[model samples]
Each structure stands twice: as structure tokens, then as C-alpha cells.
Target: MGLASASLFRTCGAYVILAGRSEARLETARQRLGDAQTLAFDITDSEQVTEALSRLPEESLDCLVVTAARVTHGPFAEQPVAEVREMFEARFWGAYGLVRAALPYMRAGGAIVLFSGVLSRRPGMNCAGLGAACAAVEALTRGLALELGPRLRVNCIAPGMVRTELHDRVPEERREAMFRSTGESLPVGRIGAPEEIARAVLLAATNGYMTGHVLDVDGGHTIRQYATRQ
Candidate 1:
């Protein structure tokens, strides 16, 4: 999903700096993205983030997007404390650290995009930890928008189910069924493609006046309270 957003930005003529923990993946992105830059830093490690960005031309940064997420799904009672901590570390503090370090380089008129999810607003069982993580992201995005404005803008894209490798954890048959059922339940009658979510990220990153907004790119999932497949 992070790569998708980066690719979208690149296609739209933005110079992208892809950051991640995997050197091999970063190399692949560098090659794949042609002119885009890559940085390998674990956002969970504050020192690594600081060191990495400090080495870069900070003033070159115009937009920031936080999409690295640790996907966790399990009953709250069964979810390990360490797992919950890891989720918050990656989802919340990861964004927090990046913003803290990047702000030094960011001037007025820049934009920062963060990723939340529909689960934050419509969580089902076994998604408590993810929901909490996403809720914190939304809260942070809103607060930062107010605090960082009228200079920088901040917003989150709360996406519904999208066809990505994130769903590859499930078996093909089950995944297909889940997607079908989920699509039928929504007004759009289909699950989303990753590019759709990426487009929203671009909007959040490019739009001058949109700040503190949690833009829902769901296929009307949140509004269809009474709409369900038979």
C-alpha cells in the first residue's frame, strides 16, 4: 500500500523518497521507481529516523505520508501485549516520530498524509487493536492539522477493504468469498482497488485547503447501516 501511494505520487510527477525498514525492498523500489529516492529507516527507532533524515537535504521534503502499518487481527483478550505495543509503535509513534523529525525541514504550505481505516469507525470483532491504532492516527492527524496550520496541512485517508497483499494472508478461496460478500454489502457493490486509495492519498497530499479531514474512501460502507446483502 505504501509503495502504491509512492508510485501514484511518482506518476503524478512528484519526486518521492521511499522510506522503509527493508534495504532489499528499498532497492527494489529505487529500481522500480526510476528517479524516486529510497531511505531505509525503521520509523519505530527514533534515532534511526533522526539520523537518516539529518543526512538528507531536509528542505527537499514537501510532503509526508505515513502508511507503514502492522496489521493485527485477534480477540483483544487473546492479543499479546507485545503485539499491541508493536501496533501502536508502528501506527502511532511511527508517524509521530517522522513528523517530529521532518517538521524541522518542512516549511509552510507543505502537506502530510496519514492512513487510517474504516475499522476505526466500524470495527468488528478481532479488530480491536487495529481499531485503536487507527483511532489514534485520526486523532493525531486532526490535532496536527490544527497545530500545524495555517502552514502545513494534515489529514488521513480512512479506506475500506482494498485488494492488496494485505489480504493475501488468507487463502485464495476464502479471500475471494470475503471480498465478494463485502462488496455486495456496500453501495458500490465491490471492494476497492489499491489505486483508488492511492488517488485519495494524492488528493490529501496535494489539496491546499484540506486539513484535519478524515476522508473516507470506502464504497459507502459507513453510510449503509441498513444496506446489507441478503
Candidate 2:
């Protein structure tokens, strides 16, 4: 989703800076982007985030779109406490710290687009930890929008299941089957594409009056349960 957002922003003639933990993957993505600056850092580490942000060449950021998260799924009882903490460190604190650090470099009227997931609201079984982290992000979006208003806009994109490399860890056959079944179950009759979610990020960034909003780019995943109800 980050890559897709970067591509879309680049297409719109924006100078894009792509940040992630993997130098190799960031380089590959930068190659695809052709004109983007890449910063490789562990967002989960505050020192690293600060150091990375310090290296940005631009004087002020017009928009900051964050799509990095540590995703974990399992029953609450079965989920390791350490793993859950790690998820929060990466997903919640990472975003919080980055935004705070980047505030000095953000131009007035700039936008900060954070990422959550549909599970934050329309949660399923075995996703308690993930849901909590996502919910925190959404809440932070609203709070920050109110606190930082009239200068910087803050919003969140809560996307549903999308086609991304995040699922590659699963066996290919199983992954495809999961996607197929999920796509069938959604109201749109298909899962989301990364590009679709990217479009929402663009909208949030460009729309001046759209602060403190958690825009759902979920392909109707949030409404699926209600739609299926008798």
C-alpha cells in the first residue's frame, strides 16, 4: 500500500520519500518509482525514526502517509504478550512517534494520513490484538486532528483486506484460497486492491476539509455482516 501510494503521489508530480525497514526492498520499490527518495529505518525504534526523519532533504513535508504496521492474528489467549506489545510498538507507538517528530518539518495546511484497518471496527474472531492496535490509530487520528487543526490535517485510512505482499508468508495455495473466499464474501464480490486504498490516501491528503476522518476503503467489508443479515 505504501508503494502504491508513493506511485500515485509520484504520478501526481509530488516529490515522494519512501521510508521502510528494508534497504533492499526499499531500493527495489524506489527503482519501480524511478524518482523517489528512500529512507530505510525501523519505525518501531524512536531513535531510528528520529535519525531517519532528520535525513529528509525537503524543507517541509506537504503530506505524510503512513501504512506500516506489525500485523498479528490469533486468539487473544493464544497470542503471546510479547508479540502483542511488539505489535503496539510498531503499529501504534511508531506512528505516534513519527508524527510527533515530523511535526516540526510539516508545512502549515499539510496533511498526515495514518493507516488503520477495517478490523478496528468490524472485527472478526482471533484478531483481538490487531483490532486494538488499529483502533488506537483511529482514535489518535481524531485526537491529533483536533489538537493540530487549522495548521495540519490529520486523517486515517481504514482499509479492508487488500492484495499486498503482506500475505506472501502464507503458502501460495492457501493464500489464494483465502483471497478467493474473502473476495466472494465481500459485498463487492472481490477483495480490495492496493491501488484502491492508495486512491483514498490521495483523497485524504488533497481534500482540504477532510480532517479527523477515518475513511473506509474496505470494499464494503464493514457492511458485509449487516448486508448478510436477514
Pairs of residues clashing in candidate 1: none
In Å, residue 204's CA in model 1 sits off its true spot by 1.0
Q: Candidate 2's residue-wise lDDT over 58-108, tens digit each?
A: 447999998888888888898899999999999999999999999987989
Global local distance difference test of model 2 = 0.91
Candidate 2's C-alpha runs over 4 A off are 57-59, 226-230
lDDT of each: 0.89, 0.91
Residue pairs with backbone atoms closer than 3 Å in model 2 (clashes): none
lDDT of model 2 at residue 21? Answer: 93
lDDT, candidate 1, equals 0.89
